[model samples]
Target: MEETEAATEKAKDLIRMGVARAALLEPQDKVEVDVVPSALIIGGGIAGMTGALNLANRGFEVTLVEKEEELGGLLRYLHRIYPTQEEASDLVKAKARKIRENGNIEVLTSAIVTQVQGFFGNYDVTVKREGKDIPFKVGVIIVATGAEEFKPVGLYGYNGVNIVTQLELEVMLKAESFTRNNVVMIQCVGARDDNRNYCSRVCCMTALNNALILKERNPKAQIFVLYRDMQTYGTLFEDIYRKAREEGIVFINYSPQRLPTLDKGFVNVFDEFLGEEISLLYDLIVLSTPMIPHPDSGELAKMLKVPIDEYGFFLEAHVKLRPLDFATDGVYLCGSAHWPSTVSESIVQAYGAASRASIPMSKRRVIAEPIASVVDEEKCIGCGLCEMICPFKAIRVEEKPGGRIASTIIASCKGCGVCGAACPQQAITMRHFKDEQLLAEVMALAEGT
Candidate 1:
């Protein structure tokens, strides 16, 4: 009888506490958003062009902006694509031709975006062309700026004449001017080291592709490839590696501790597989360097209110779930701007970005969660501290008739309570997390205890 009485009393107390907590809660407000149906694509590379075409075909207007005068990006410098041996120029021409025929895509060559204003789904951008600012509005923005090859300067005595980078070797191969029978190609030139700890992802395949090309050009060519680790992943790349070996191209494994050295007219490297140092005379030396992000990517990331990684590559919202989209809605990224991806990988990401951008445009409306920060305008000093502290760029202080006050873009706010904590005048607070409501719970609990 005593145990039953205690249990019943405990249940009653729990019910009372639940009721008290419910009484302290307040209703949530709705945030209505209307999405625009246009897109702005930066970088007129293969990825940018592919994304523009996909969106255009889906009946959306696209503005394709290119910093250069032409459409093809790094592809223009390549001789042939890997695994398929497709002419790089032919592929570029086909995509550029399709873009030209598409009426929905507005190509802006020799133009650069100088300024970007407004929020997601409604952006007012200013493009600079020939000292003139061209202003336009768009719903979505895609970043497809490609990467640049790292120049292996001072490493292994690299000179443009004899010891050249992979990119330079492509030019010689395309022009059929590479007549060197004794060739030595060094992999991981500027990557996979303490300076750059990430793999270029396409260097191994590039080496294999070029090595096979040289073999095909001259049957008597003797090529030696020195690599830290061969990254020939996937079936197609693996087949290419096998063919290189079948064609009698010798591959030597080297360690970073004992990198290949240039001594006199010969290259000396400690072969890890053979467990011995070997020296070889080379008529031409090819250094396989990694692809690096552009220097001005930071400026563009700031303009779009997006984030970049330590290596200057644009960061996605999530590595697996949201690989092509940014945390900022209506903005997406693809191609080498994100990482060192091959042509096919870049195209796949471009298509994925286009698909993600289409979702908001197709819906035409977005309803954000009501759990956002609320601003007490009367207490606000417009100090602009909240704007500076906000990681999502959700809050902004504007000038009103009386004075400056902070306003929250409820759609963009993640309700992280950062603005509330940083507010000097106690002007910022979350909708569901008010001071009085929190104090009510604490008081109720204290009384029960």
Candidate 2:
């Protein structure tokens, strides 16, 4: 009886504190902003073209920009695709044709985004083309700027002639002039090392596909693949891997500590299974290098005010919840810009990004959540700390007639409470999570209410 009475008194005290705190708290207001109803896609690769077609087909205008003179990015250079063994050029051409025929889609070649301003559902983008600036408004932007193959120039004594990269090997295969009977392929050339530390994802399959092609070309050709690990993960890829082995292609696993040494006409490696060093004469050596982020990725990330990982790939908002979106609401990402991906994977991601971006434009308005950062002009000292600390650049210090003051772009604020925590003068507060409201909840829990 005594313990119950004490608990009741504690609960009563917490209820009183909660009531007082609730009285001081105020509800936040919601803002509705108009959307532009258009999108900007920054790439003309398979991913970008697919995204553009999807958006245009759905009745949304799309501006597809490419840095190169034509569309088809890296797919244009490939001779054939894996698993099904389809002609890569035909696939790229079909997609390009669809994008070109779509009236709602505007294709811009040899163009680059010079500037980006405004916020979600209302962005002002400027593109540079032929010594001119083309400015336009867009509801959202998708970055599909694909990656480039890592040039393994000096590593493993790569000479680009006999010792060529997988991409270069594709060119030789396309020309049908690769008449090397004794061929050797080295995997993970500049990847999974101390410098890169990534798998490259597609190198193993590419090497296997090319190896099978060579075997088909020359029945008695001796082809050897030296790999760290075979990543034939999917069902189709696994089937091809088995087929390569059945066709008498030799696969040898090597350790990073015992990498293959390349010479003019011979390659030496320590075979892990055989537990012995082996030297084989080769007419051609192909290095399966990784795909790295483009050189312009940094500049583009800065211009869009989005985050990129340490390796320079664009960082998405969340790994699961918002895989196609950036922390900035108006921006989306797909293809190798996010990571090294195959053509099919890039197309899937592009479609996902396009669908995600179309939501606001289709709605034609943005209803901002009530929870956001609010500024207290009286306590603000214009220190600019909040402005600098904001990842989304949601806060800015403006010069008024009286003095300088910090202001929040309500639409741009993600309600992350970053500015509130960074403010030294206690001038910023996050609505719906203010001090009084949080304290009331805390006291309520403490009293077991």
Indicate which candidate wins on TM-score.
1
Estimated TM-score for each candidate: 0.94, 0.91
lDDT of 1: 0.90
Report the Cα lDDT for residue 26, model 2. 78
User: lDDT of model 1 at residue 180?
Assistant: 78
TM-score of 2: 0.91
- Model 1: per-residue Cα lDDT over 192-233, one tens digit each: 888898999999999999998999988899899999899999
Give, for candidate 1, the lowest lDDT window spanning 10 residues: 440-449
Across residues 100-218, which tens digit of lDDT does each residue of candidate 2 receive? 78899999999999998778887889999999999999999999999999998788778888889999889888977666799999999989988999898999999999999999989
Over the full model, what C-alpha lDDT does candidate 2 score relative to the true structure? 0.90
| Segments of candidate 1 deviating more than 4 angstroms | 1-19
